[model samples]
Target: MGQFYCLHCDRYFANSTVRDEHFKTKRHKKRMKQMSGPAPHTQLDAELAAGMVGKARAPDCRGTLGAVEGLPFIFLLM
Candidate 1:
């Protein structure tokens, strides 16, 4: 992996492919637009995630889930 700093976006990217993908994602464009306007409530999202994780884990009744060991690996590969 390699690092590249995108000055226009004011962020560091791990690789060129990821950086290109970011440029194509709605979020990055939205962030740039927000920079000229208003930023989203990211702190609120963090708080929500924290609260959810803080709650006791209930068994996932939706279905039997296998170990989530390779989820990220699978996503990245895809």
Candidate 2:
């Protein structure tokens, strides 16, 4: 359950150490090269990527876990 996913490559790691290792690997870096850049997506973009309906919603300020996919990698709400 503890893992970090590579957004660019859609890969996952069990821990930060492994994640860091993956980041350093040639294959991982190569995959990263395929990305447009490190620009963060806007809330609207993130919502669309998460497959939500019109009017992107922000996660509850109460810090509750809501609908999500590939959790730990992408949080759709919160």
Best by lDDT: 2
- What would the TM-score be for candidate 1 when compared with the true structure? 0.35
User: Compared with the true structure, what per-residue lDDT tens digits does model 1 show for residues 22-78?
Assistant: 798887787677687644445534444455423344333123212332233222353
lDDT of 2 by residue, 1-78 (tens): 656888867877788888887788888888777675654545545555566734335443123223342344435786
**Candidate 2 colliding pairs:** none
Task: Name the lDDT value of residue 46 in candidate 1.
Answer: 48
Off by more than 4 A, model 2: 37-78
TM-score of 2: 0.41
Candidate 1: 10-residue stretch with minimal lDDT:
61-70
Top-scoring candidate (TM-score): 2
